[model samples]
Target: MRFSIYLNAQTPGPQEDVGIIQTLARQAVEATRAGFHGVVLTEHHFSGYNTYGDNFMFAAHLASQVPPGTKFSLAVAVPPLHNPMRLAQQCNLLDILTGGELIVGFAAGGSPLEYAGMGRDPGERHAQMAHNLEILEAALAKKPEDPPLEWETAFEHGTLHTRIMPSAFHRQSPAFARATQSDSGAEWAGKKGWYLFSAREKPQALAGRWRLYKQALRAAHAEEVVQDRLDWSMVQKQVYLADTSERAEAEIRERLVLMADNQRRSFGHVKDLRDAAHLKSVVGVSPQNPDEFLDHAMLIGDPASVREQIREYEAAGIRHMAMLFNFGFMTPETADRSMRLFIDEVLPAFTG
Candidate 1:
C-alpha cells in the first residue's frame, strides 16, 4: 500500500525542450512534499519517448533534492549494456548519495536497438545480462572474507584490493529483475528472491506470471520469503479526482485521448506482435470511450469511486501502486493540478 510517482518527463512534440530537467526535479520535490513514499524514473535511449537518458546519474543528482524521508529508485537499470564492475561502482555511489534510499532493479535491455547499436547480438543479450548480474550481486554481497589483493608499491608490494565504494547502509540495497510479459521472468526473479514489477496492461497475463512466480517460490522454498514479502508492483497510467464523476470525466477525457493516441503511435512502430487490446487494457486507456476508461485502467472520479477502483487492484496482490501524474503529453500545470487534487482527496484513503 505505497504510492510512488513514475516521471516519464513526457514533452510535447517540437516544443522548446526548455527547463525540462529542473521541471522534473521540481515534480519530484512536490511528490515528496505531497507525502508520496518514492519516485521511480524510467530509462530510455534514442526513443525520444522518455526524458531520462541515464537514470543512475540523474538519480544521484535528484537524490540530493528529495525531502527528508522520501525514497529514490531507478525503477529498472538496463544491465546488458553496462559493465558489471562499473555498474556496481555507480550503484554504490548512488546508494551513498541517497542515504540508502535506492532500490535498484536490473533488466536485460528492452530496447533491442540499444543493444544492436552497441554491436551486440540481441539473441545473446539475456545470457550476458545474467552473467553481469551475477557479478554485480556478488560484489554487492561482498564480505570481509572475500578476495583481497596487494598492489606493487615502491616498497615492492603485489596488487591492490579494490574496495567496494560508497558502502550501502544496508547489507545490500534491494534489487529486482524486470519481469517480461510472460511468467518465465517472474519465475526467475522468484527463484532469486527479487521483487517483480508489473504493467497494468493484461492484468490477467501479469496475474498468471505472479502465479508462476509464487509456485516457483513455494517449490524452491525461497529464503526469507512469505506471502507478505512477495513484493510486487503495478503501474497505473492515469489518475484524476474531482467533485463529481461529471467533472472528472470532463477534465480527464482530453488527456486520456491524447495518451491513447500517443500509445498507438509509439507501439505501432514496435515490430513483431501488436496486441492493441493488451496495450489498451494495461494502460486503462481507450480512444473510443472516456466514460468507461475508469473501468479498465484508471482511478478517476470522486473519492469514493477512486477508492473503490483501487480496492480491486489492492485485492489483486499489488503491494505497490505507481502513478503517473501526467500521462501522454499533458501540460505540467494540468498534471500538477491532478496531483494536488489526488493528494487532497484520493491518496489519503489508500494509505489510511
Candidate 2:
C-alpha cells in the first residue's frame, strides 16, 4: 500500500497567503522525508478556493525542494478549460523538469462559474473535454507516424509541423491517470488503459465504479501497468488521527465543518444541484451537521482504529490512499501534529 498527503489549499483569505504556501512547502518536504511517496494537488479558479492556484507552477516549486524520488501529481486537471496543445506541452515539459516523476489525471469536474468565467458553456464541458483529449493524444504522439498535426476546438486551433519541444524522458509522455465519479467516465478511463483516481464517496458506490473500471481495464491493453498499480489505483479522503476517537471527532466537527461552510461560499449555485452529492467540490462535507459528514465522508479516529479502517480498504483492493491531513483553515501546527502522529504510529503498520 502507498500513502500520499493531499495539500488542500483552502486558505482563509489573502492575508495569510504567504504563510500558507510556506507551510505547504515545508509539509511536502516533511511528507517526503517520511514514508509518503507522492504529493497530490487540485486545480480550481476564481473561487478563492484552491488557494495555491496554479497547480503547474506550485508543483514545479515543490519539485525543486523535495527529494528526487518524490512524485508530483495533479489529481484531476480541468481539461475543458485548457487549450489541448498547450496542456500537452505543459505535461511533457514538467515531466522533464521532474525527472519523469509526474503523472497527470483528467476529468470534466468543476463549478459552472469556472467554465463561464473562462467563456465556456458548462453544459458542453464533457464534449469539450472529449475534444480536448483527442487533440491532446495527437499532441503527445511521437514522430514518424503521421502528417502535420492540425487540430481545432472551441478555444484553440493549431497546426504542429514540428513536435512538442523538450520531449519527455525517453520521448514518451508521462503515465496518465483519470479521476471519475461517473459510470461512463470509469468505463472510458478503463478503455484508455489509464490509471484510476476515485473521489470521496460511499464505500459501496466506489466499489461499483471500481468494478466497471477494472472490468474494462482488463479488456483493454495496459502495456506498462504492473499488478500493484491495478490494485492500488487511488482514492482521496479527509483524515485525522489522535489519542482518542472522541478527540478526533470533536476537532473534525469544529474545523472540517467550518471548512465546509467556507467551501460552500465558493461552491455557490453548484452546491444546490440535485446530484451535487457527487461533486468533487463538496468532498462530502456537511456544514453544521458534522455527524453526517463524519459518517459518510472521512477517515477520522485514533491511530489504532484508523489503521483498522485502512485494513478494510486494503482488503477491498485499495493500495494507494490519498489522504487530506490539512484543510478547512486548520492551523498548520495542529495539522502537522496529526500528520506526525500518523507518520509515527499508523503509517508504519502498512508501509513497513
Candidate 3:
C-alpha cells in the first residue's frame, strides 16, 4: 500500500490564505521526509470548499521545493474550463520540473456555481470535458510533423500548432486517471486504459465498480491489458489521527458538519434525484453524531483504530489512499499534530 497527502489548503477566510499555503508547504516537505509516496492537490474556485483555484500552478511551485523523489498527483483538474493546449503545456512543464513525478486526474466538475462563474453551462460539462481530454491527449502526443490541432468551441476557437516544449519527462506522458461516478464513466476510463479515482462509496460498492471497469477493459483491449494490475486506482478520504479516538472527534467533529453544510449549499441546485444521490454519496449528509459521520465516511481515530480502517481499504484492492488531513476550518496546529501522529504511529505500521 502507498499513502499520499490530499492537500485541501482550506482556511477560515482570505485573511488566512498565506498562512494556509505555508502550512501546506511545510506539511508537504514533512511528508516527503516521512517517506510518504506523494501529495495530491485539489482544484476548486469561487467558494470556500477549497482555496486552490489553479492547482497546476500551485503544484508546479510546490514541486520545485519538495524533494526530487516526492511525486505530485492532481486529484482532478477541470479541463473544460481550460484550453486543452495550454493545459497540456503547463502539465508537461510541471512534469519536467518534478523530474517525471506527475500524475494527472481529470473530471467533469460538479459545482454549478463554479461553472456559472466561469460562464459555462454545467449541463454541457461532460461532453466538453470529453472533448477537451481528447485534445489534451493529442496535444501531448503530437510530434513536430503533426498538423496543428484545429477546433471550435464556445470558449475557444483556433489552430494550435506549437508542440509542448520540454515534453513530459515520462516515457509516454504522466499517468492518466479519471474520477468517475456512473457506470458509463467507469467503462470509458477502462476502455481508454486510464486509472480510476473514486471515493465516498462503501467497499462493496467500490468493488462492484472495479469489476465493471475491468470487464470493460477486457472487452475493449486484449488479455495483456486486462492482466496488468497496478495500484494506480485511488480513493480519497478525510483522515485525522490523534492519541485517542475521543481527541480526534473533539478536534474535527464540528468542522466536519460545517464542511457538509458547505457542500450542501454548493451542490444543492441539482434537480435530478440520481445526481443528488450520487452527490450525497460522495459529499455525504450532515451527521447527528461524530461517530456516525466517521463510521464509513472518514478515517478518524487513534493509530490502532485507523490502521484497522485502512486494512479494510487494502482488502478492497485499493492501494493508493489519498488522505485529507486538513479541511473545513480546522486550525493548522491541529492538522499538523494529526499529520505528525499519523506519520509516526500509523504510517510505519503499513510501510514496515
- The best candidate by lDDT is 3
Q: Which 10-residue span in candidate 1 carries the lowest summed lDDT? A: 151-160
- Any runs in candidate 2 off by more than 4 Å, and if so which? 142-146, 222-228, 269-289
Q: Write the per-residue lDDT of candidate 1 for residues 55-118, one digit (tens) a residue.
A: 8887877777877556665667777677665677788787777777667776654444344445
Backbone clash pairs for candidate 3 read none
lDDT of 1: 0.64
Evaluation by TM-score, superior candidate among 1 and 3: 3
Clash count for candidate 1 is 8
Q: On residues 1-352, what C-alpha lDDT tens digit does candidate 3 reach at each position? A: 8898888865567898888887887888888778788889988887667776788888888887777788788888999888877788878888888888788889977566667667777667779988888888877887878888786665987776767676888665777788876668778889888778876656776777888888887888877756542366778888988899998878677777787677666666544423443434333423434565676568888999999988988877777888888887778888888888899998998898
lDDT of 3: 0.77
Between prediction 2 and prediction 3, the one with superior TM-score is 2
Candidate 3 steric clashes = 0
**Local error of candidate 3 at residue 72 (angstroms):** 1.2
**CA lDDT of 122 in candidate 1?**
49
lDDT of each: 0.64, 0.77, 0.77
